[model samples]
Target: MSKDLLTVSLDVYLGADPVLCEIVPNSSCGDVDSEDLEKQPKRSRKASVKSEDISRSSASSRARHDPVSVLVKGGVAVDPSLEEPLRSNAHVLSELDTVWHVMLNQTNISMNSNKFYLIQLLKSDTEDKYWVFIRWGRVGYRGQTSLTSYENKLEEAKKFFCDKFLAKTCNEWSNRSSFEAHPGKYAIVATKFEVPTKKEEVCKPEPEVLQVSRLDWRVQSLIGLITNLQKMEEDVLQLEYDASKFPLGNLTREQIEEGYRCLKDIENAINTKKFDAVFRDSVNRYYTCIPHDFGFRAPPLIKTQEDFKKELLLLETLKDIEVSYKVLRSARESKDNRAHVDRFYDKMHCQLHPLERDNDEFKVSMVSMYLSLGHGLTHMFSMEIVNVYSVYKEDEYRRFKGSIGNSMLLWHGSRVSNFYNILSHGLRIAPPEVPLTGYMFGKGVYFADVATKSGNYCHPSNGKCALLMLSEVALGESQVLYDANYTADKLEQGKNSTIGMGRKDGVRVPLGPLEDCGGDGGRYSLLYNEYIVYDVTQIRSRYVVEFNFRL
Candidate 1:
């Protein structure tokens, strides 16, 4: 294929609108300068490809090809010559019913493979027919496709679809809500869709709408944050790491392990006063294991402890990017690709309701405390509380408050990309395989009494937005610590939680009349008040606040 023609093919494969790239017949895709092509807009350049010329070239290039099936409107397969029937068929199936659609992803960092499989079942609107379409391949590529037709046999089609889903995911389709991932198998990826509802529109304003409009301005800000999923997705995508440097846009588990080991060695070297050859070798080893794309410029060496810490953080960020990229690829490959990220929340079974700015006493107290607590050491940066939202997870909340007491709302924050899994699975303890160097207080769900302390974990830089969650933590009987304790998870006999005593005080007033457990009676002095819970059931996510930090 010609250079220009190849670009067109890539564009089509990447889910660009084909209608915009109208191909002029009997024309050649002329050679264009590389520099000039780079300057031109992508849409403008796509129009230059000659469809007929490329089609003929592609046909001549292939050997022993199967019967070509062309997909037209309404996903109906037709012969190229019988184009007239497509219009009528599409019109008939305009309101086609979707029986089922699933997108699955399997990423084995150990094997360095990231792939996606999409299966869809659709029922004909005008006829007794069902279509089963399946597509599978490495992400960011067009991949292979198969279309099976079941004439007047909906049961057979459904069976075929379910069988395929089970074969790929090793999980029953009916029990997908409780999805379990098996070794060396695809995991069912959760996706959200905006299906049109058939409810008749009422002329009068909804009580909920009136209630929301009368909320306090601060509460309104919180409402805006929860409702604006589009903005949140954009912020998450902006938190990108360079994936193009890795093989198939995936970081292998081996690479991650090696990177962590290197960081640990450097940390030890710094403490032992061996920052010469030992530190240099560790730094070199890290760069070798984790390939970075520095282009023409020379890659910098990690010389100081601060630099070593930054590299360690980068390795962790890469892991998050790998996960977010796979989810994004699966969403893009599906038929209904609109608002894919926003729909992720629906798949996780987590609901976010905006707190009333005016009438909600809880919102008023929470916002007031959040703003007022911005004094002392935490008040260095200007804090803007963008939105406040009440989180509801039926199973977690119901199971959480069973025998727990002395609950107080505290702050938790994480990177935007991590929220995809964080909100889905709730906060999780680090597995045995993960490195312990990053977790100062060990593998547990950590929270903070001060917003800035938790907000720092969001890693906000360059004026980007970050997400923070306030959860009702049941810290019944806590063990106090001032220094790092790697084995903090091995709690003593009766302690329900661990409190890291900090130098600064949190909220002066009680956070919503909850029983206040004052700081460690000024016994130990740490930087900030850190709350760590070993059990996941001891926490109930209360509010998620999105805010921007201005330097």
Candidate 2:
């Protein structure tokens, strides 16, 4: 095997963000020459006479930008001296030839006048021209993107960045408040690749506080289940066995332990009852950040009665699955006879089978349950279904949010188009009315109906009209406000709008009569997207499914 020896170079901008005002790099110790400063046009006699006044004014301005700079003027070494690379040749030859290797000229700004801009220069032997790259982003996002530019000479390229640096400084001064409002909008420059050791060490919003309320019985119950889950995880980790043949066929005991650990973390989040924190923590375990292009935020957590209720339902389902696992684990641990174990396995398998068809999260949970139960029994009794079920289970877990970039990938397979199908099929029975809610896993246009109390009596036999026609813009499109008068033309106008307003992490769109559906007059013709059709009669019935969809 051979490794590519590609050189790389970075000009990073780091330090308090770009603020207007000129505090040129003070290379007083060495390196810069006096001729550099002297190579400038002389000021007029009038300007020269007022140089003292100008100096005082500039001092006042510098003090406003940085108080420490005021101390620096009084002979204190407040800022660290600029350090140069050991060799100039090494610096010039270090340009990375490959594209998108992470290291690019980036900048980080901190207090005490540490803000600066960098220009990356990459040498291309084949093209015989150096490639220029600069970091660009909005006022306050860590989402600095490396943009490519052309330059015939290195000095010109450096000058380009210097100019950009000045412009950015002025822009920063004008938009400092804007930058402060957006978290993780600045480009963070680091000396070397390092992992964050603390939560606040990284650029992110502070975690919201959790409050346990007795008014919500589900929260109380979830807290108890979380405590039990923690204990179970500890027990699983303490298990001593030869994991080399663990699961007896698929995952080692270590692998199973890892899954347990992930489950425990999620359970802890549930116990917090802090909706926002739970959603962020749960998704972050699997994704670095939500794609900015999607522009949609993770649904808000715990903002309304409906929001809490939905969370309660989700937690309840998770608790039920977890409890079922405990039963199977106990049976296996007791070394029950083959017949007894088989009975337990069959019973549990039937219970989990329906869940496998639910949303991605529920499906992943079912997989985890099967893996733990199957592996424990197989390790103890040399079972045979280990390979088959273990493979299926592992595959499902991989598709979940916690499993390494799984949430960002394109899922190419059958999608759950109907929300009602998931609830009815998952629970194994349909109720008179089940209030259901879930997140939008993939982007596309969807048609749904929200059951409302207004239509319960007026037209009893009219049936359910498609109250809201929802459309998820592009993959990178952000979720927008509810547009009651949204039309397919507006969608083409490049604005992302849904039929309903967001409720925490779910959507709640009001249902009104549609003219095309032959109900009382209301606008529904504009709801049509690419195609307009009148087929597919209204699905009216007593059993209605209330929707809470999050994009």
Candidate 3:
């Protein structure tokens, strides 16, 4: 990309935060033609002679009030002599002992120019020197410049922040108290603040420090899981996988080991119950500097288009589900049905359709998602008859969150709807072969109705759940036994022996209100000691099932 078209981000350590007076960027740099910048409006400068000018500008119009801000000072600090060097783009690194307060265009600079090098900030909790960088090159600009230039600039910029502003030895205050955490390993930057300065009399209040009382061991496990997952990226690239597969390994054992070490370093903070501390430290080390004395910031925007729109929605939904599921399971454990659904509309809103087109991988994922979620909710909500249902539920959140994007796509495209259609068609409409799945109860109730999929539910009758299992049979074609004006004496075919071939095209039957067999409910149904409807929709067979439990 062309340098003119390039965008830069700054990582600065702001000791005071946005509460302080905004500092205008330096007016000059070591390189670049000051004459040109001086002659033209110092667009990089936040301070100006007029209020109207600020409003007129669009992108950088918003004045930033960071106690510490890094300025990009744009377009290569022009120096006539280094024209050749800058044009050729030779790598150069240097540090200046003098306070970088004044701009090369000193006549225009008003604030203390003590800060130089485009990026400067006091260390967090410690005082030390930290480095900020000026990465200039073309990105996305259709120029002859090599792509590596952009990458190189980014790498240098990253290094500058890591090495300088975040000097490991920095103290709480940058004035003098900076010190290294380890012996012999001095902080990348020298200590700046140790004792109070005379000028420091009144101080602004700081927000209450965020704290972690207990380490959620899950975090460590998750981090390790993610770290290991990288190893499988390339390996699984060929094998189809989605967010659900993020924890899978993608690399060799050695690389995985290295990744684990990195994960541990990151994990240690959480394990030690110091999440916010580590996070803030990293912020100081990485995000404090502004680029080129302007609004240059670089942070990976992990959110996608859909993510932005649905993140809050999904987050709230998840939270609600978690809470409600907890309550529902508790009520069941206590054998109470008082846990009425909260925000019923919200739950309804979550109902999503599946993809319209063929998405085999997505299809498989939907299958898993539905089954898992169904299983959890069923197993947790009801102690009995949980096994009678074929649907499963789960919130394997980590896996789901990762796959949410694609799964949502499928959901949007009617894939979700289609899935339900399949089940409906097989069990309630018609089926070639009876569908059969293992059932269990009250183990992992998550977020599904145990007795029925039909939203229509009645309060439990005593401790027993009343559910209706409707089985449909197509005349002569369906395997589910039914009594729809047909002969009742056929052991030749059908799921239940009590019923017989129906003259009608289809039929619905209530399966169970299973009376405890190590559970609250239990019941068995078969035309010939076997379920005849295999699955819904996918198979165009004649039999379907309609199961209803008054639950």
Q: Pick the candidate with the highest lDDT.
A: 1
TM-score of 1: 0.52
TM-score of each: 0.52, 0.19, 0.17
Query: What are the runs in model 3 whose C-alpha is more than 4 Å off?
Result: 1-551
- Which has the better TM-score: candidate 2, or candidate 3? 2
Residue-pair clashes per candidate, as listed?
4, 27, 145
Q: Give candidate 2's total backbone clashes.
A: 27
312 Cα displacement, candidate 2 (Å): 16
State in Å the error of residue 233, model 1: 12
What is candidate 1's lDDT per residue for 14-77, written digit by digit as tens?
1121222323221232111122112211211121112211112111111111222233333222
Displacement of residue 515 (Cα, Å) in model 3 is 13
Q: Choose 1 or 3, whichever is better by lDDT.
A: 1
Clashing pairs in model 1, backbone N/Cα/C closer than 3 A: 216-357, 216-358, 222-387, 222-388
Q: Provide the global lDDT of candidate 1 against the true structure.
A: 0.54
What's the best-to-worst order under lDDT?
Answer: 1, 2, 3
Candidate 3, residues 269-343, lDDT tens digits: the string is 433545454433332221111111212222322123232222222222222223333333343334222221222
Task: Name the 10 consecutive residues with the lowest summed lDDT in model 3.
Answer: 406-415
Which regions of candidate 1 deviate over 4 angstroms? 1-241, 247-258, 261-282, 293-305, 331-342, 359-361, 460-463, 508-525
RMSD of each: 14.1, 26.0, 25.6
